[model samples]
Target: MSERLTSVPGLLYGGDYNPEQWPEEVWEQDVKLMREAGVTMVTVGVFSWAGLQPGPDTWDFGWLDRLMDLLHAHGIAVDLATATASPPAWLVRAHPEILPVTADGVRLEFGSRQHYCPSSKAYGQAAVRLTRKLAERYGRHPALALWHIHNEYGDHVTECFCPRSAAHFRDWLREKYGTVDALNHAWGTAFWSQRYGTYDEIEPPRTAPGPVNPTQLLDWRRFCSDALLALHRAERDVLTATSPDIPATTNFMSMMRELDYWRWAEHEDLVSDDAYPDPADPRAHVNASMNYDLMRSLKRGRPWLLMEQAPSAVSWRPVNVPKKPGLQRLWSLQAVARGADGIMYFQWRASRAGAEKYHSALLPHRGTASRGWRETVRFGAELARIAEVAGSRVTAPVAVLLDWDSWWALEGADHPSARMRWPDLMRPWYAALHARGITADFVPPHADLTGYRAVLAPNLHLVRSADARRLTSYVRAGGHLVVGPFSGVVDEHDHLHDGGAPGPLREVLGLSVDEFWPVPDADAVPLASGASATLWSEWIETAGAETVDTYAAGPLAGQPAVTRHAYGSGIARYLSCHLPDHIGDVLDAALAEAGVTACVPVPEGVEATVRTGADASYLFLLNHTDRPVAVDADGTDLLTGAPVRGAVRLPPLGAAVLRRPHSPDSLDSPDPANSPDPLGDNRS
Candidate 1:
């Protein structure tokens, strides 16, 4: 068997296909249209648990068998789902105890999907049985390309405060900490007299009067993620045992805080994600790029798949906004530019009736003449033209640190300011880099930073001693480092460091935080560098560093707001305030210090990325603005097969993929970049 999961020859293109929803005559038309749209793969049976198994023992595979056979005959492959995403009403009605209980002690009903608790034994066993049956029936089918595990693991319900889940949490705690004394030490239970004498005393951190124990809340978050993962593993084991060669995957909600993807990615044969960037948000593409980078980085630069995206507008948002004329193709190609091996969507055909009836699809309600259908056909043709870029790689010189543990702890209750969101602080830094045409990868705090020119930790509220040591060594070995506010403040156990804030990183950062003065919402304070800081500011006393900037107003006036220190062979810069407006300036200095530059400079609002294969490198340029722009390049425009010498012109909301002879850039030699071209003629 091949190492790759998708057995298709070129870049895979398709979406979720539900033959059961439509009549038998419509199935024929769907297959014909799939061929016309150049779709090679489709996800089947995602939410078909009810239809597949009407009762506890009854089974129905006649319709599914025919659909599978029809799809195979038409040359379309199947990423078959285990069909356990949502349990059937029969199962839930029979075992009402399996329903999830919210923290308020109300058992949720089964009107919506994903109503079962993660720790419910009845749910897990039923999911495993169905997965095993599917694997046995279609394991050797020619159309079976991949096995999709439970769809979007933690999308609707992440945590369940029911008695079953509470028991599972206690079991998990027992395994992690052998004794109650150790658990008390880890949770710092001495503060509120919340010490635990036995594992049975601990619960899932249900609703409390004032504030829950921070450490218990953190552990609850951890347990919730693991519980869902355990459920996935149960079904995965069945699939793998039945069809060992076929790869298995589950679609991840991009950057979801409910599950720790880094830990979950370890079990996946192929990393895949479902991305839905709002059409209303102008800067949505920037955040999407970060999410795409995280997906690729989950498997250490291995090529991943774009499991699902909106063809146009999504129904879930308050104000549903449709994609403009060329916006769909532009954003889809952006995923390829970031590192997606394939592009797929949430659905194939628009539903006639459902909660998602308004969600856009490849074959819309207006049929072939619709703008969405026409655009889909055109985009599929374009993907086929540049199929050679499928297995290519993207490389980056910088890494942004992301840790789910820190995210859970930082966003928990009783912090310096509730206004300080993890992603809010991260977006400005990443957006600055995207604007600079510089690519970056998201890595864990303990990830190896050997090849990266510079590393940035936006906020590591929870850092382990080992992670701090690795970072210290990286800086000592001539790697530029930048750490944001409130970092190194606590250990993994959520206990404050001995000296103060910036615990283990104090020596490397060359400063100590005396106090955290968080400004009120919509308030700003003056900085000595002429840039105003908002949301967060810290009083600092430098140990062995040079003060870069100081607060000019407020109680912390004249105090250092930003500082730089000379470590072993490199420099460590610290930003002690929320400086979204001036992050680009700080990053520019770090880039200069680390000798990192953009892959190829382009005009503002134009995105530039490169993917390198063994023989050649492909340069991708995307014009995100409403006007045409020219970017310097030298190679063949893969979309048109036209040779380019100097520059390539991209129209409004346009893109270009140029295939050139490979030239190894030293900084990103080990990392990889994402996907391709838009124009037919070379006219710069």
Candidate 2:
């Protein structure tokens, strides 16, 4: 047994393989095609609970054993799943209580996947039993490389309102708070005369006439996340105990709010993510890069795996647009540009029957003669050319702050505005950095910020005293800090801070918010800096900070819209309104002040990133436009044997991974006159 995912050379390339769906005769052809595609590994038995166990007393491992042997003979590794993602009809019929209940009090039947309750005792016991069974049988199997616990934990059933879940929620509350009095105080139950007398009276925030207590809803979300995490831990413990050398993991949906990936990453030996960036979105690459950066930062810059993606169009979305020619290869390399050790997809072959029958796969229904199959083979060969990129790390000098607790708190029912979506507000900041060719890593509020030159907190709406202290200490220790609007307004318990807005951060920022003025009905507030803001505005009365920008024409015309405070050895900047246009200026000023430079200068749509290894550094330049763009570089392109001297012209949707043996200074930005026109129309 090996600790890593595979022992073969090069980056892993493969997808989920369900051998049971096809006849035994087709399995040989599948392995031959896998070898041709340069696939080193494949995930097996993800949704095979029914086939693996025909009945409670009857067991069938003959088919799995033969498939494992067949794959091993063909020199392909296996990421064997525990086959507990979807329960069989027998289990559900035996204990119908295992089925999840919606908030509207409807017991959901079990036709689709992920239909079990997170807190069901019966379900947990059965899942653990199956995990132990698999581990015991495959502990010494030659093809086993990694153990995938279960498929996407909180995808369909994030929270359950059944009686079993209510009981589990009560138990979780007791463990977290220890007493009814403590729970009431933490939840602020005194509001709306909703104080509880005992723990037995608590429920899972079921459907109510009026709005439920905000804190209660927050706690319910926390408990639901924890309940799902407990299931993963239970199954993971069996595998680790059975085969300690083999690492265990479960696929994570990128930026999923249901389960906290930061907390979940702590339990994983290797982090793997499933990302689907819509092809219809023109700027989908920008947001997809943000998720990739988050995956890299989850385990502190460890190289993770891209578990699932569509080779072409996906079947789920309404429109279901196909990935344009060369788009899949471009985005796949983009993942490698960030930090993905392996590239995998949902299914190896297209499904002939099922809900996802129309979903794209490496081997489409047209088989080996189709363009999709040709592209798949080409992509695999491209991955083989850059095998040295494995085990390298990407270091970022700038960090963007994201906290799950804050995200759960900010999106409650009763808020200042219904338009304050976390992802929408945070994407702009990341896009600003991306457009400037500045690579950034996502960090939590309490993460170690000493390594970063600047830290951007786009929206930390819920911050406790400890989180505030960490930010203050980071700024005092010579790190630039940027605080966004509607931040520091509430504590961890969903209770408002006593001192007002920017509560614990008031002293560091040197300002206090008088009131939040959310602009109504498509109105823009003009700023003295010649830029306009929309959606949100805050009235601030600075005590010791300098006003950098102010409201130009409004009731609070002379009020400060942006302020800067000089702390111990650094500066703290605050934006009181949502700056849709001028955010780049604010971030550029901060980056200049902190002495942070971009990796390289390129055209507007081009992306630049670097991955450093023990012996060499690789610079990735991706041209994401319809025309060729020129880039200055001096290295060998790994994709091609050609040597790049002064500059290289990349064709439309082209990519180049340059291997630099020495001279790290090549990453520094060139002089203004020598640099390429960043916003010019470089139409080749």
Candidate 3:
């Protein structure tokens, strides 16, 4: 199965198909239409639990059998569903403990998918039984290309406070800290009058107004994440025991707060995600770019599937905003530019009733006669044309260090500042790279850094000794390293390392931080480029670092907000403030000094991305705006099959791919003087 998938030309094209919702006669028509549109796969049984097992004790496989047989008779492969997204109504009613408990201690009713209690014994047992049953029945089937686990786990509100959850939390604590004393020290319960004499006394943190304990909330988040992972593992173990060759994956919501996907990535055969960008929002590129990097990095540069993107607009979101013309196809190509192996939509055909009835689909309510269908066919044709050339292409030379343990450790600390949010600190640097047409892979802190030329670690609050050594060696070998301010404050156990700010990394970074300035009420700090920026806090370096930039005009004026240190033939740059556009120029200069630059030329309000393989190179030029712009490049336009010798005009929100001849010096050929400078634009 893996070999077959790897040998496929370009990205796989297909999506979710629910034949149980329609009559048997309609199935043939649907298959005919899908083949006409170049669909090669169909996901089955996503929301079929109600149909598969109508009662608590009885199970039926007749409908699923017919559906699978029909799909296999055609040439379309199948991503077999686990049917565990939602339990039958009888099972939920019979075992009420399966329902989830909210953070406020409220038990929810069983009405929606992903509402099952993670810690419930009955729920876990039932899920395991059903999963094994399904695996045993169809694991050896030839058409099963992948194992699709329960759909989109942990999308709703999280945290369970029931008796089962409480007991599991106690057990998890025992395994983590071994004793109450160690737990107390890590959580810093001494200041809150919340010292625990016994494990049973611990409780999940409740939302309140002031001075809440960060450690307690952090542990609760970790516990919730682990609980869901256990559910995933339970299902995966059963599937693998039966069908070891089929890849197993659960579709993830990118950067979701409830489940830590980094931890979950270790258990799956491959990573898959659902991406739905808000069309009304102007920063859709920023959001989509972040998720693409995240998905790619989850498997350490292995290709992942875009499991669920709306064909047009989603019905569940309030207002049901439609994707502007050309945006859907552009976004699909954007996914390929990152590292998606397959592009699939949520629903192949729009539903006639239910919560998602209004969701747009390839075959909309008007069938194959409307603008939606026309666009779908056009995109399908485009994909077929480029399929042979785009397959197996890789992106980027730069890497970003993302530590899951670091994320957990920082959020678990007993810090004094309320403004230190993790995502806000990481987003700026990520956006900086994306705006420059550079693809940055999100690597785990402990990952091998032998091939990368530049490394960016943003808000890496936790530092492992082994990872520090690797970074040191990479720098010593003449690789660039960029470490942000809130780094190296804690260890894996969420406990302070204690020597100085940045702890173990201080030696490698060559800086000794004295204190951090928690800017509580300061307005946006003006930059030299006439832009203002806001930051949560800025680190005040007292000694042992060269100041690169300072606050332009404020109480902190003339104080260093950015610093750089030379170490072993390489350098380390530390950004101390929330960077505005002006600071991006400084970052670009640093990147240039390190002998790395953006892959393509970027225009204002346009996204420039590059994907390359052994025999072909693709340059994606995307205009992410409402107005048209002129673009000029030196290559053959892939879409038009014509030589692009000079300036080319682009329409509003349009995209074009240039198929340049592949060579060792292709990246270096576009001279800085002739190319549009990415750092000159600040719109992103």
Best by lDDT: 1
Task: Give one clash count per candidate, in the order shown.
Answer: 13, 0, 0
TM-scores of the candidates in the order shown: 0.97, 0.96, 0.90
- Model 1 residue 335 CA deviation in Å: 0.4
Better of 1 and 3 by lDDT: 1
In model 2, which runs have C-alpha deviations exceeding 4 angstroms? 1-5, 663-684
* Cα lDDT tens digits for candidate 2, 288-402: 9999999888877777889899999999999999988899999999999998889999789898999999999999999999999999999999999999988777888888888
Better of 1 and 2 by lDDT: 1
Best by TM-score: 1
Inter-residue clash pairs, candidate 3: none
Cα shift from native, residue 173, model 1 (Å): 0.6
Instruction: Estimate every model's Cα lDDT from 0 to 1.
Output: 0.89, 0.88, 0.75
**Tens-digit lDDT string for candidate 1 (88-190):** 8889989998899999998889988899899999998999999998999999999999999989998889989999998999999999998999999999899
lDDT of 3 by residue, 197-291 (tens): 98889866655656567666667778888988898899999998898878889999987766777778888777888999988888887889889
RMSD in Å for all candidates: 5.0, 5.7, 5.3
- Which stretches in model 1 have alpha-carbon errors above 4 Å? 1-3, 663-684
Q: In what order do the candidates fall by TM-score, top score first?
A: 1, 2, 3
